[model samples]
Target: MKYVFDWEAFGGCLGMLVVLALIPIGAFVVYFIFNAILFILPAIVAGAIILAIPVGLFYAFKEMVFKKVE
Candidate 1:
């Protein structure tokens, strides 16, 4: 006995194979995006702290050292 060629079934199988191959590539892209977010969040927090410290010190000096004048 001989088998017949089935183009539809073959095409479906090929499509599935391509989808399976892409899964890992998608995962790598997602992983890098999360890493970029992780790095950016810390830099933003550090920037806010760096800005706050100066303003806080100025207020402290005005309240403490200049208390007698006011």
Candidate 2:
């Protein structure tokens, strides 16, 4: 059976998806030489931290601040 529609929630999700799709546009606009270097260095550092950190704490905080244990 099909669930009844909620247009408001659908519209909100569509808006979020549109905003997310704009991220690559911003990335492309940042391809200028100096700006590219500026962005790339920090991204490398952040990636290193992701790889360096311990697995459990890394994934937990990366996803959310407080995760409950059952």
**Highest-scoring model, lDDT:** 1
Q: Candidate 1 — which residues are off by over 4 angstroms? A: 36-70
Q: For residues 1-70, write the lDDT of model 2, one tens digit per residue.
A: 3345456655655575466455555554555535766677555555555464456344543334333344
* Candidate lDDT (C-alpha), each: 0.54, 0.52
Residue-wise lDDT of candidate 1 within 1-70, one digit each (tens)? 4345456655655575466456545555655777766655555555565576557546643444332321
Structural similarity to truth (TM-score) of each candidate: 0.42, 0.43
> How does residue 33 of candidate 2 score in lDDT?
39
Q: How close is candidate 1 to the true structure, as a TM-score?
A: 0.42
List candidate 2 segments past 4 Å from native.
33-70
lDDT at 29, model 2: 52
